[model samples]
Target: MSSPTPSTLRVGRRYRAKRLNGPYDAIVIGSGIGGLTAAACLSKMGKKVVVFEQHYTAGGFTHSYDRNGYEWDVGVHYIGDMGADHTMAKRLFDHVTDGELKWAPMDANYDRLFIGDRQIDLMAGPKAFVDSLKNDFPDEHQAIDSYMGYLNQVAKALPGVTLAKVLPNLLAGPFRRLANRKAPAFLNRPTQEVLEGLTGNQELIAALTGQWGDNGLVPTESSFIIHSLIARHYLYGGYYPVGGASEMAKTIIPVIQQSGGEVFTYADVKEILVEKGRAVGVLMADGETVRAPAVISNAGVYNTFGPLLADNAPHKAFYQMKLGNVQRSMASVCLYIGIQDTAENLQLPKTNFWIYPGTDHANQVDNFLKAPDEHDIPLTYISFPSAKDPSFAARYPGRATVEIVAPGPFEWYADWADKPWGKRGDDYEAKKEAYSQRLLEKLYEKMPQLRGKVDYYELSTPLSTDYFCRYSTGEIYGLDHNPERFEQDWLKPKTRIPGLYLTGQDVMTCGVVGAMVGGLLTTVAISGLKGLPLAKKMFVG
Candidate 1:
């Protein structure tokens, strides 16, 4: 073994102006899961691709960091649909990582929702999930059954919906219409509306939408499509990457290099070089121009259209119009906690805890946003990373880690956005400390044993998110998963600009798997007929 350096946790080579080996086939900006996936997929098809990341690490949100001898994942808490080898998510992951990345199944009781005094446990497997819910609300069995049926319907309708993103407008228009007709009329309706139509029980609706935090939307505002997708995704329960979230990029990078491609960290992309209305290359922050036939942006639509692409691009007006249709997602604060003892000794469960002030999720969120200090936190999500990842002990012996995530509007932290990280004045530090203490109290509410057991903890505000992730407003998920967001036709892989494409959570939905799937869809859209075999294997086989 080697001694760990400051850059030990980071993957990918450091960006240097002299290291340009292009005229590559594709230049992917942002080494997030979406960008890495696209580069790896294209590389597998004998294309020389290069990925540029502004962060010190490669994995945008998937990267894990070690601090004070403890490691914690930045964004990736858990992923779904990895239990079976034949699943599309599993297959794609295997293909990208060359079967190197592994997954560990979470507890059968994957999520525990604490709604005031009432507690609801969402178990793994369809039958078990329904049974558990039915156990809680015996009188609303019919509604539960109906909800499950809608999930099934959404699952059935998803392929066509995904296909439309890759297909041209001529082919996609008819296909999307057919797919829409096949799906339920209420499929794209507001989640709250759909659930209320099924049953008048507010508590049941709250319990059903407990996982709304997964997509950063309230039941009243989120589209039922996203609601159904997130619900169906975790029906089999959650799974953490076996070697930690960073393993995703660590393993995938090798596959990308197989075809002479590389993912570069600290590679700040200044702008997408457009010539004659075509994205021909990218201008680096260091004043180096790397040319490629294609330019794919895994950065969100705002970054691509607002900053990367020039203001005078051919489709500037069109994209600006498209941008008006969608809105940025949630900003949050995460308290990364480190425990001195081992996870096993500390008795931590792999099950995630979703603590809420009350059953009224939407109202609570609205109230909290209005005056954060006045009201209690709308939702507090607690995840045991050390317990979830089986290999944590081997990596960092006698250490355990926990992450507490709660919504924090960007406006609250806007004043400190321009301040350098770690030097944000005393007032900012005091605010973070206040929030951190409150979050610690919430954690102690469930597991009081961890009160003094916590060895170290640090709170990350929205400013930290903006600094690291480049989300100006510290939006966690790229775009809001609302009804309006889904209706935007421009949120697809292929953009109006020639040789320009979009991928990541913005293109599809949020979540690690969602963005990776978006990357796959972008590969298909870019490859056109050449990608059919890969598509058939993934979507068909």
Candidate 2:
């Protein structure tokens, strides 16, 4: 295999003290979709904002990287609700990117589930999704219909939940009460509990929650709201960015720049500077202080409250206590595979594949965590990025890429956490190779034609996530989407510290859309009455 080359996919300007465009309206920490969205929206409001990103490239998880001769996205696999112009997600994305970013639909059968020996395909469209499952389990028609109804219910109730995040505590109280009265009892319950209440068929339930890996939790642990949000978000089908995942930051950065704002890469914020109980600015790792009236943190909650905030920062103790309420989401290992052939020639499908050991998702996860080597791999999600992206063939001709992701506990690689990125020692390399081969075997089991066709591949563990994304525990999703996580009203955009605010997946749920909504709410919170028009345009339209 050939050695890797320096990626030409870098986005955002590199950080430099001389590059500072000071006296900015707002300063955003982290360039994840949430931060970028907030900054872009603020820019539209005529507010000059500056975004700081610690990574070599911006877009947080949305960024894509190239190696040897292949490119792969880190987080964005597929997004739904992009097929039409009416969806809130679509409108928000359009507003931020000024309609520059485009999307391409995946196959009608967007997701394929391999549960034990059974093969199930989640077809696009509400009717097709229901019919596809009904066709497999002919007797569970009512259960499937009820499940779809619940997803619709969650969709309707979601706006109220969003409203509570942006509205003041006093004003949001009534809305919360009204929403609770109107929402179904199972809306915030455990996913498995809600599905079990609807049906007793284990296979059917397993099939309904087959996409559990999308939220990084099993049905028994994750909230019904998150499950329904994910299920409903992709109800139509999955869509990929026209170019690639990096197109997100690539498109949005221009909007920020248009307003005389900038997104800087390699901009490490050492601490969020506080003064007189208000967020004043950020102290950079280079010891330079950049001040803005408002500070928005797109970094996850743990990072925001833990290391970013000084120990004596106002309300830091309260946030530290609140942090104990939620848990970090699961981490994973992804194997990026490169093949020296066109996706068409390789016969790669655009549909994502979810492989599971059996119908009992919770137990499988538990068993695997107990003895990763001995038990069957709980879940393996495979995505064909080269096949999904239309521009991939033209960008890197005669090359295709495949990514396989599976649950990898942080503890599995904790010993190597203190080590550097590329020099984690031979033991770490051996362990990663073992996991890579196992994951490759799973791919071969599904597509035997590509066994020897693979030209190169590399495995990235939780340690890599820490090294690049600064997620200490290597969690992909900011926080666990368990039932308790949803009940925490404190996880909103506004913070007790006057000028400080929060955004990203921690503020809402996980996924690209969820984090973007978090950014939208943060903008609304900061703009107050001035943002009412923007909020209406995004949520109401």
Best by lDDT: 2
Model 2 lDDT on a 0 to 1 scale? 0.94
User: What is the Cα-based lDDT of residue 237 in candidate 1?
Assistant: 94
Model 1 local distance difference test score: 0.91
Q: Residue pairs in steric clash, candidate 2?
A: none
- The residue pairs that clash in candidate 1, if any, are none
lDDT of 2 by residue, 406-505 (tens): 9998999999999988999999999999999999999999999998999999999999999888899899998999989988889999999999999999
Question: Please, what is the TM-score per model?
Answer: 0.98, 0.99
User: 1-541, model 1: which lDDT tens digit per residue?
Assistant: 2323557788999999878677699999999999999999999999999999999999999998888878889999988889998888899999899999999999999999999889999999999999999999999999999999988888888888898999988988898899888988988899999999999999999999999999999999999999998998898999999989999999999999998898899999999999988999999998999999899999999999988878898897888888888899988999999988999998999999999989899889998899888999999999999999999988888889999999988898888888899999999989889999999999999999898888899998889888988998889898999999887877899999999999999999998989999999999989999998998888776
Q: For each candidate, what is the lDDT? A: 0.91, 0.94
